[model samples]
Target chain A: GQQVMQIPQYQHVQEGEDFTTYCNSSTTLSNIQWYKQRPGGHPVFLIQLVKSGEVKKQKRLTFQFGEAKKNSSLHITATQTTDVGTYFCAGRFYNFGNEKLTFGTGTRLTIIP
Target chain B: DVKVTQSSRYLVKRTGEKVFLECVQDMDHENMFWYRQDPGLGLRLIYFSYDVKMKEKGDIPEGYSVSREKKERFSLILESASTNQTSMYLCASSFPRTGNQNQPQHFGDGTRLSIL
Candidate 1:
Protein backbone atom coordinates (compact mmCIF):
# COMPACT_ATOMS: atom_id res chain seq x y z
CA GLY A 1 0.00 0.00 0.00
CA GLN A 2 1.13 3.55 -0.70
CA GLN A 3 0.91 6.31 1.86
CA VAL A 4 1.61 10.06 1.69
CA MET A 5 2.36 11.68 5.02
CA GLN A 6 2.53 15.43 5.69
CA ILE A 7 4.34 17.15 8.48
CA PRO A 8 3.14 19.90 10.87
CA GLN A 9 -0.48 18.84 10.88
CA TYR A 10 -1.35 22.39 11.88
CA GLN A 11 0.47 25.68 11.42
CA HIS A 12 -0.19 29.23 12.62
CA VAL A 13 1.75 32.22 11.38
CA GLN A 14 1.54 35.97 11.46
CA GLU A 15 1.09 38.01 8.35
CA GLY A 16 4.39 38.45 6.47
CA GLU A 17 5.80 35.28 8.01
CA ASP A 18 6.91 32.25 6.09
CA PHE A 19 5.52 28.70 6.28
CA THR A 20 6.44 25.33 4.89
CA THR A 21 4.96 21.81 4.83
CA TYR A 22 6.72 18.57 3.97
CA CYS A 23 5.28 15.46 2.36
CA ASN A 24 6.87 12.01 2.23
CA SER A 25 5.60 8.94 0.47
CA SER A 26 6.07 5.31 1.45
CA THR A 27 6.78 4.24 -2.14
CA THR A 28 8.29 5.92 -5.15
CA LEU A 29 5.82 8.05 -7.06
CA SER A 30 5.56 8.85 -10.73
CA ASN A 31 4.18 12.27 -9.94
CA ILE A 32 2.74 14.32 -7.12
CA GLN A 33 -0.03 16.89 -6.96
CA TRP A 34 -0.77 19.63 -4.48
CA TYR A 35 -4.22 20.82 -3.46
CA LYS A 36 -5.68 23.39 -1.13
CA GLN A 37 -9.03 23.17 0.64
CA ARG A 38 -10.53 26.24 2.15
CA PRO A 39 -12.71 26.15 5.23
CA GLY A 40 -16.01 24.47 4.36
CA GLY A 41 -14.89 24.16 0.75
CA HIS A 42 -13.74 21.41 -1.56
CA PRO A 43 -10.17 20.63 -2.43
CA VAL A 44 -8.74 22.73 -5.29
CA PHE A 45 -5.76 21.72 -7.37
CA LEU A 46 -2.73 23.89 -6.78
CA ILE A 47 0.07 22.40 -8.82
CA GLN A 48 1.70 19.16 -9.95
CA LEU A 49 5.33 18.05 -9.98
CA VAL A 50 6.53 15.34 -12.31
CA LYS A 51 10.29 15.38 -12.86
CA SER A 52 12.58 14.43 -10.04
CA GLY A 53 14.14 17.35 -8.16
CA GLU A 54 11.74 19.63 -9.95
CA VAL A 55 10.62 22.95 -8.50
CA LYS A 56 7.67 25.07 -9.49
CA LYS A 57 6.34 28.35 -8.20
CA GLN A 58 2.97 30.02 -8.15
CA LYS A 59 3.27 33.60 -6.91
CA ARG A 60 4.05 33.39 -3.24
CA LEU A 61 4.10 29.60 -3.08
CA THR A 62 6.93 27.31 -4.14
CA PHE A 63 6.73 23.52 -4.63
CA GLN A 64 9.60 21.07 -4.82
CA PHE A 65 9.79 17.39 -5.65
CA GLY A 66 12.55 15.30 -4.16
CA GLU A 67 15.19 13.64 -6.30
CA ALA A 68 13.85 10.22 -5.38
CA LYS A 69 10.28 11.24 -6.23
CA LYS A 70 9.20 10.01 -2.81
CA ASN A 71 9.03 13.39 -1.11
CA SER A 72 7.81 16.93 -1.76
CA SER A 73 7.55 20.28 -0.09
CA LEU A 74 5.44 23.42 -0.25
CA HIS A 75 6.76 26.74 0.95
CA ILE A 76 4.89 30.00 1.28
CA THR A 77 6.65 33.33 1.44
CA ALA A 78 5.18 36.25 3.33
CA THR A 79 2.00 34.45 4.26
CA GLN A 80 -1.24 36.33 4.19
CA THR A 81 -4.61 35.88 5.87
CA THR A 82 -6.01 34.71 2.57
CA ASP A 83 -3.70 31.67 2.77
CA VAL A 84 -5.75 29.98 5.47
CA GLY A 85 -6.60 26.43 4.42
CA THR A 86 -5.45 22.84 4.55
CA TYR A 87 -2.74 21.95 2.04
CA PHE A 88 -2.68 18.38 0.81
CA CYS A 89 -0.12 16.42 -1.22
CA ALA A 90 -1.26 13.50 -3.34
CA GLY A 91 0.93 10.98 -5.10
CA ARG A 92 0.52 8.60 -8.04
CA PHE A 93 2.82 5.61 -7.89
CA TYR A 94 4.87 4.45 -10.86
CA ASN A 95 3.37 0.98 -11.29
CA PHE A 96 0.10 1.64 -9.50
CA GLY A 97 -3.03 2.11 -11.52
CA ASN A 98 -3.98 5.68 -12.35
CA GLU A 99 -7.56 5.25 -11.25
CA LYS A 100 -6.94 6.68 -7.79
CA LEU A 101 -4.56 9.00 -5.92
CA THR A 102 -3.19 8.58 -2.42
CA PHE A 103 -3.68 11.83 -0.48
CA GLY A 104 -1.66 13.08 2.42
CA THR A 105 -3.15 13.89 5.81
CA GLY A 106 -2.61 17.61 5.04
CA THR A 107 -1.21 20.60 6.86
CA ARG A 108 -3.74 23.10 8.08
CA LEU A 109 -2.41 26.66 7.73
CA THR A 110 -3.79 29.59 9.67
CA ILE A 111 -2.62 33.18 9.38
CA ILE A 112 -2.90 35.89 12.00
CA PRO A 113 -3.63 39.41 10.94
CA ASP B 1 -13.11 26.29 -15.26
CA VAL B 2 -14.25 22.77 -14.35
CA LYS B 3 -17.31 22.34 -12.19
CA VAL B 4 -18.34 19.25 -10.30
CA THR B 5 -21.70 19.24 -8.63
CA GLN B 6 -23.00 16.99 -5.88
CA SER B 7 -26.66 16.19 -5.47
CA SER B 8 -26.83 17.28 -1.86
CA ARG B 9 -24.89 19.46 0.53
CA TYR B 10 -26.15 17.59 3.55
CA LEU B 11 -28.08 14.37 4.13
CA VAL B 12 -29.42 12.35 7.03
CA LYS B 13 -30.35 8.68 6.90
CA ARG B 14 -31.15 5.87 9.27
CA THR B 15 -29.28 2.63 9.82
CA GLY B 16 -30.00 -0.17 7.36
CA GLU B 17 -31.20 2.29 4.76
CA LYS B 18 -29.67 2.42 1.34
CA VAL B 19 -28.03 5.68 0.30
CA PHE B 20 -26.81 7.16 -2.93
CA LEU B 21 -24.53 10.15 -3.45
CA GLU B 22 -24.75 11.56 -6.91
CA CYS B 23 -22.03 13.54 -8.70
CA VAL B 24 -22.02 15.32 -12.04
CA GLN B 25 -19.21 17.04 -13.85
CA ASP B 26 -19.70 19.70 -16.46
CA MET B 27 -16.36 18.86 -18.05
CA ASP B 28 -16.34 15.68 -20.10
CA HIS B 29 -13.60 14.06 -18.11
CA GLU B 30 -12.66 10.46 -18.73
CA ASN B 31 -12.15 9.68 -15.06
CA MET B 32 -14.34 10.12 -11.97
CA PHE B 33 -13.71 9.25 -8.36
CA TRP B 34 -15.50 8.96 -5.02
CA TYR B 35 -13.74 9.67 -1.72
CA ARG B 36 -14.48 10.11 1.97
CA GLN B 37 -12.88 12.81 4.10
CA ASP B 38 -12.44 12.54 7.84
CA PRO B 39 -10.72 14.86 10.30
CA GLY B 40 -7.39 13.06 10.33
CA LEU B 41 -7.83 10.58 7.51
CA GLY B 42 -7.74 13.14 4.69
CA LEU B 43 -9.30 11.93 1.48
CA ARG B 44 -9.54 8.15 1.03
CA LEU B 45 -10.60 6.89 -2.37
CA ILE B 46 -13.57 4.55 -2.36
CA TYR B 47 -14.11 3.94 -6.06
CA PHE B 48 -13.25 5.30 -9.46
CA SER B 49 -14.30 4.97 -13.06
CA TYR B 50 -12.06 5.50 -16.06
CA ASP B 51 -14.82 5.30 -18.59
CA VAL B 52 -18.52 4.75 -18.77
CA LYS B 53 -19.27 1.22 -17.50
CA MET B 54 -15.63 0.83 -16.46
CA LYS B 55 -15.02 0.83 -12.73
CA GLU B 56 -12.31 0.01 -10.22
CA LYS B 57 -12.09 -0.36 -6.45
CA GLY B 58 -9.99 2.10 -4.47
CA ASP B 59 -8.32 2.10 -1.10
CA ILE B 60 -11.46 2.05 1.03
CA PRO B 61 -14.19 0.36 -0.95
CA GLU B 62 -15.35 -2.13 1.66
CA GLY B 63 -18.76 -0.57 2.29
CA TYR B 64 -19.28 1.15 -1.03
CA SER B 65 -20.04 0.58 -4.67
CA VAL B 66 -20.05 2.87 -7.71
CA SER B 67 -21.89 3.47 -10.96
CA ARG B 68 -20.81 5.17 -14.15
CA GLU B 69 -23.61 4.97 -16.62
CA LYS B 70 -22.47 8.15 -18.39
CA LYS B 71 -19.18 9.93 -18.95
CA GLU B 72 -20.12 12.92 -16.82
CA ARG B 73 -21.87 11.16 -13.99
CA PHE B 74 -20.57 8.98 -11.15
CA SER B 75 -22.47 7.67 -8.18
CA LEU B 76 -21.50 6.19 -4.84
CA ILE B 77 -23.85 3.74 -3.17
CA LEU B 78 -23.93 2.62 0.42
CA GLU B 79 -25.60 -0.75 0.78
CA SER B 80 -26.64 -0.17 4.39
CA ALA B 81 -25.97 3.08 6.15
CA SER B 82 -24.29 2.89 9.52
CA THR B 83 -23.08 5.40 12.11
CA ASN B 84 -19.50 4.70 11.19
CA GLN B 85 -20.25 5.60 7.58
CA THR B 86 -20.97 9.20 8.50
CA SER B 87 -18.47 11.52 6.85
CA MET B 88 -17.99 14.13 4.15
CA TYR B 89 -18.14 12.49 0.76
CA LEU B 90 -16.41 14.08 -2.19
CA CYS B 91 -16.74 13.45 -5.92
CA ALA B 92 -14.05 14.40 -8.39
CA SER B 93 -13.44 14.20 -12.13
CA SER B 94 -10.32 14.43 -14.26
CA PHE B 95 -9.00 13.90 -17.72
CA PRO B 96 -7.20 10.61 -18.24
CA ARG B 97 -3.42 10.85 -18.22
CA THR B 98 -0.98 8.92 -20.36
CA GLY B 99 1.78 6.66 -19.12
CA ASN B 100 2.77 7.48 -15.54
CA GLN B 101 1.66 11.09 -15.65
CA ASN B 102 -1.14 12.36 -13.40
CA GLN B 103 -3.96 14.72 -14.16
CA PRO B 104 -5.50 17.37 -11.99
CA GLN B 105 -8.81 16.52 -10.36
CA HIS B 106 -11.70 18.92 -9.95
CA PHE B 107 -13.82 18.35 -6.88
CA GLY B 108 -17.35 19.17 -5.88
CA ASP B 109 -18.28 20.86 -2.64
CA GLY B 110 -19.01 17.43 -1.09
CA THR B 111 -21.95 15.85 0.73
CA ARG B 112 -22.02 15.69 4.49
CA LEU B 113 -23.81 12.44 5.23
CA SER B 114 -25.04 11.43 8.65
CA ILE B 115 -26.37 8.02 9.55
CA LEU B 116 -28.39 7.66 12.68
Candidate 2:
Protein backbone atom coordinates (compact mmCIF):
# COMPACT_ATOMS: atom_id res chain seq x y z
CA GLY A 1 0.00 0.00 0.00
CA GLN A 2 1.22 3.47 -0.85
CA GLN A 3 1.42 6.10 1.83
CA VAL A 4 1.63 9.87 1.63
CA MET A 5 3.15 11.72 4.55
CA GLN A 6 3.35 15.42 5.29
CA ILE A 7 5.85 17.41 7.27
CA PRO A 8 5.15 19.94 10.03
CA GLN A 9 1.99 18.51 11.55
CA TYR A 10 1.23 21.99 12.81
CA GLN A 11 2.46 25.49 12.01
CA HIS A 12 1.78 28.89 13.52
CA VAL A 13 2.82 31.96 11.60
CA GLN A 14 2.36 35.65 12.19
CA GLU A 15 0.22 37.48 9.70
CA GLY A 16 2.07 38.58 6.54
CA GLU A 17 4.59 35.75 7.00
CA ASP A 18 5.06 32.80 4.66
CA PHE A 19 4.12 29.14 5.07
CA THR A 20 5.05 25.95 3.30
CA THR A 21 4.06 22.27 3.67
CA TYR A 22 5.81 19.32 2.07
CA CYS A 23 4.21 16.05 1.00
CA ASN A 24 6.01 12.86 0.04
CA SER A 25 4.61 9.59 -1.21
CA SER A 26 6.09 6.15 -0.62
CA THR A 27 5.61 5.34 -4.30
CA THR A 28 5.64 7.31 -7.49
CA LEU A 29 2.45 9.18 -8.21
CA SER A 30 0.66 9.78 -11.48
CA ASN A 31 -0.80 12.99 -10.12
CA ILE A 32 -1.28 14.87 -6.89
CA GLN A 33 -4.04 17.13 -5.61
CA TRP A 34 -4.10 19.67 -2.78
CA TYR A 35 -7.09 20.39 -0.58
CA LYS A 36 -7.90 22.83 2.18
CA GLN A 37 -10.25 22.19 5.08
CA ARG A 38 -11.36 25.10 7.18
CA PRO A 39 -12.48 24.78 10.75
CA GLY A 40 -15.97 23.31 10.89
CA GLY A 41 -16.07 23.09 7.11
CA HIS A 42 -15.67 20.47 4.43
CA PRO A 43 -12.53 19.97 2.41
CA VAL A 44 -12.24 22.20 -0.62
CA PHE A 45 -10.36 21.42 -3.81
CA LEU A 46 -7.36 23.69 -4.25
CA ILE A 47 -5.25 22.44 -7.16
CA GLN A 48 -3.66 19.44 -8.84
CA LEU A 49 -0.30 18.86 -10.47
CA VAL A 50 0.64 16.05 -12.87
CA LYS A 51 3.83 16.95 -14.63
CA SER A 52 7.12 16.21 -12.95
CA GLY A 53 8.91 19.25 -11.55
CA GLU A 54 5.94 21.32 -12.49
CA VAL A 55 4.94 24.46 -10.62
CA LYS A 56 1.58 26.18 -10.53
CA LYS A 57 0.56 29.38 -8.87
CA GLN A 58 -2.82 30.40 -7.50
CA LYS A 59 -2.73 34.05 -6.53
CA ARG A 60 -0.41 34.16 -3.53
CA LEU A 61 -0.05 30.40 -3.28
CA THR A 62 2.44 28.23 -5.19
CA PHE A 63 2.35 24.44 -5.67
CA GLN A 64 5.24 22.31 -6.83
CA PHE A 65 5.54 18.69 -7.89
CA GLY A 66 8.85 16.97 -7.37
CA GLU A 67 10.98 15.82 -10.27
CA ALA A 68 10.47 12.18 -9.31
CA LYS A 69 6.72 12.63 -9.09
CA LYS A 70 6.81 11.21 -5.59
CA ASN A 71 6.67 14.50 -3.71
CA SER A 72 4.86 17.80 -3.71
CA SER A 73 4.82 21.09 -1.82
CA LEU A 74 2.50 23.98 -1.22
CA HIS A 75 3.74 27.45 -0.27
CA ILE A 76 1.71 30.43 0.64
CA THR A 77 3.08 33.96 0.54
CA ALA A 78 2.04 36.72 2.96
CA THR A 79 -0.22 34.44 4.94
CA GLN A 80 -3.37 35.97 6.29
CA THR A 81 -5.87 34.93 8.93
CA THR A 82 -8.06 33.57 6.17
CA ASP A 83 -5.27 31.13 5.27
CA VAL A 84 -5.65 29.27 8.53
CA GLY A 85 -6.74 25.67 8.07
CA THR A 86 -5.49 22.21 7.38
CA TYR A 87 -3.82 21.47 4.05
CA PHE A 88 -3.80 17.97 2.63
CA CYS A 89 -2.00 16.37 -0.28
CA ALA A 90 -3.54 13.41 -2.06
CA GLY A 91 -1.99 11.35 -4.80
CA ARG A 92 -2.77 8.36 -7.01
CA PHE A 93 -0.02 5.78 -7.13
CA TYR A 94 1.55 5.27 -10.53
CA ASN A 95 1.30 1.48 -10.64
CA PHE A 96 -1.72 0.98 -8.43
CA GLY A 97 -4.61 -0.08 -10.64
CA ASN A 98 -7.19 1.06 -8.18
CA GLU A 99 -8.53 4.59 -8.52
CA LYS A 100 -8.22 5.51 -4.88
CA LEU A 101 -6.65 8.67 -3.57
CA THR A 102 -4.13 8.37 -0.74
CA PHE A 103 -4.04 11.45 1.48
CA GLY A 104 -1.25 12.75 3.66
CA THR A 105 -1.55 13.27 7.38
CA GLY A 106 -1.97 16.97 6.64
CA THR A 107 -0.43 20.27 7.81
CA ARG A 108 -2.51 22.46 10.02
CA LEU A 109 -1.68 26.15 9.67
CA THR A 110 -2.51 28.94 12.04
CA ILE A 111 -2.02 32.61 11.23
CA ILE A 112 -1.57 34.98 14.13
CA PRO A 113 -3.31 38.30 13.99
CA ASP B 1 -21.04 24.36 -7.71
CA VAL B 2 -20.72 20.75 -6.64
CA LYS B 3 -22.70 19.91 -3.53
CA VAL B 4 -21.85 16.85 -1.49
CA THR B 5 -24.37 16.54 1.31
CA GLN B 6 -24.08 14.35 4.36
CA SER B 7 -27.23 13.44 6.25
CA SER B 8 -26.12 14.85 9.59
CA ARG B 9 -23.44 17.01 11.18
CA TYR B 10 -23.50 15.05 14.44
CA LEU B 11 -24.70 11.66 15.62
CA VAL B 12 -24.64 9.49 18.71
CA LYS B 13 -25.11 5.76 18.98
CA ARG B 14 -24.63 3.16 21.65
CA THR B 15 -22.30 0.23 21.36
CA GLY B 16 -23.50 -2.79 19.30
CA GLU B 17 -25.91 -0.53 17.49
CA LYS B 18 -26.05 -0.32 13.74
CA VAL B 19 -25.31 3.03 12.18
CA PHE B 20 -26.02 4.35 8.73
CA LEU B 21 -24.42 7.47 7.24
CA GLU B 22 -25.88 8.75 4.02
CA CYS B 23 -24.22 10.93 1.37
CA VAL B 24 -25.63 12.53 -1.72
CA GLN B 25 -23.85 14.27 -4.58
CA ASP B 26 -25.60 16.52 -7.00
CA MET B 27 -22.78 16.63 -9.54
CA ASP B 28 -23.60 13.28 -11.17
CA HIS B 29 -20.23 11.85 -10.27
CA GLU B 30 -19.23 8.29 -11.11
CA ASN B 31 -17.18 7.71 -7.99
CA MET B 32 -17.94 8.12 -4.29
CA PHE B 33 -15.75 7.58 -1.24
CA TRP B 34 -16.02 7.33 2.54
CA TYR B 35 -13.19 8.35 4.84
CA ARG B 36 -12.64 8.65 8.57
CA GLN B 37 -10.60 11.52 9.99
CA ASP B 38 -8.87 11.23 13.30
CA PRO B 39 -6.51 13.37 15.36
CA GLY B 40 -3.16 12.08 14.10
CA LEU B 41 -4.18 9.54 11.46
CA GLY B 42 -5.66 12.09 9.07
CA LEU B 43 -8.17 10.90 6.50
CA ARG B 44 -8.25 7.14 6.03
CA LEU B 45 -10.36 5.77 3.25
CA ILE B 46 -12.83 3.12 4.26
CA TYR B 47 -14.69 2.33 1.01
CA PHE B 48 -15.44 3.59 -2.42
CA SER B 49 -17.73 2.81 -5.34
CA TYR B 50 -17.09 3.59 -8.96
CA ASP B 51 -20.47 2.45 -10.09
CA VAL B 52 -23.80 1.52 -8.68
CA LYS B 53 -23.76 -1.80 -6.79
CA MET B 54 -19.98 -1.97 -7.14
CA LYS B 55 -17.85 -1.44 -4.08
CA GLU B 56 -14.19 -1.68 -3.13
CA LYS B 57 -12.48 -1.78 0.24
CA GLY B 58 -10.10 1.02 1.03
CA ASP B 59 -7.12 1.04 3.35
CA ILE B 60 -9.22 0.82 6.53
CA PRO B 61 -12.41 -1.08 5.83
CA GLU B 62 -12.29 -3.69 8.55
CA GLY B 63 -15.38 -2.61 10.45
CA TYR B 64 -17.26 -0.82 7.74
CA SER B 65 -19.36 -1.42 4.62
CA VAL B 66 -20.65 0.68 1.78
CA SER B 67 -23.58 0.75 -0.63
CA ARG B 68 -24.05 2.57 -3.89
CA GLU B 69 -27.47 1.69 -5.16
CA LYS B 70 -27.82 4.92 -7.13
CA LYS B 71 -25.38 7.20 -8.87
CA GLU B 72 -26.30 10.18 -6.76
CA ARG B 73 -26.29 8.39 -3.43
CA PHE B 74 -23.71 6.44 -1.41
CA SER B 75 -24.01 5.03 2.08
CA LEU B 76 -21.61 3.87 4.79
CA ILE B 77 -22.76 1.38 7.35
CA LEU B 78 -21.33 0.28 10.63
CA GLU B 79 -22.82 -3.15 11.21
CA SER B 80 -22.01 -3.06 14.92
CA ALA B 81 -20.69 0.23 16.17
CA SER B 82 -17.89 0.32 18.67
CA THR B 83 -16.27 2.92 20.86
CA ASN B 84 -13.29 3.08 18.52
CA GLN B 85 -15.59 4.09 15.71
CA THR B 86 -16.28 7.46 17.30
CA SER B 87 -14.72 9.86 14.82
CA MET B 88 -15.43 12.26 11.99
CA TYR B 89 -16.77 10.59 8.84
CA LEU B 90 -16.44 12.34 5.52
CA CYS B 91 -18.06 11.62 2.17
CA ALA B 92 -16.70 12.69 -1.17
CA SER B 93 -17.48 12.31 -4.87
CA SER B 94 -15.59 12.71 -8.12
CA PHE B 95 -16.03 12.30 -11.85
CA PRO B 96 -13.52 10.92 -14.33
CA ARG B 97 -12.47 13.76 -16.57
CA THR B 98 -10.26 13.68 -19.62
CA GLY B 99 -6.62 12.75 -18.92
CA ASN B 100 -7.29 12.74 -15.19
CA GLN B 101 -7.89 9.36 -13.59
CA ASN B 102 -10.66 11.01 -11.62
CA GLN B 103 -11.58 14.55 -10.84
CA PRO B 104 -10.66 16.02 -7.49
CA GLN B 105 -13.08 14.80 -4.86
CA HIS B 106 -15.56 17.29 -3.44
CA PHE B 107 -16.24 16.61 0.23
CA GLY B 108 -19.27 16.92 2.46
CA ASP B 109 -19.25 18.81 5.77
CA GLY B 110 -18.73 15.46 7.55
CA THR B 111 -20.62 13.71 10.30
CA ARG B 112 -19.08 13.61 13.74
CA LEU B 113 -20.25 10.37 15.30
CA SER B 114 -19.88 9.43 18.93
CA ILE B 115 -20.33 5.80 19.90
CA LEU B 116 -20.79 5.17 23.56
Instruction: Find the candidate with the highest lDDT and give its number.
Output: 1
Give DockQ per model, in order. Answer: 0.82, 0.67
Predicted structure 1, TM vs. truth: 0.98
True contacts kept of each: 0.80, 0.59
> Candidates' lDDT values, in order?
0.93, 0.92
Candidate 2, residue B113: CA error in Å?
Answer: 0.4
Which lDDT tens digits does candidate 1 get at residues B1-116? 89999999999999999999999999999999999999988999999999999999998999888999999999999998889999999999999987666789999999999999
Sorted into a CAPRI-style docking class, model 2 comes out as medium
Per residue, candidate 2 scores C-alpha lDDT tens digits across B46-101 of: 99999999998899998899989999999999999999999999999998645754
What tens digits encode model 2's per-residue C-alpha lDDT throughout A42-87? 7899998989999999999999999999999999999999999999
* RMSD over all Cα atoms, model 2: 1.0
For model 2, name the residue pairs that clash.
none
Model 1 misplaced stretches (Cα beyond 4 Å): none
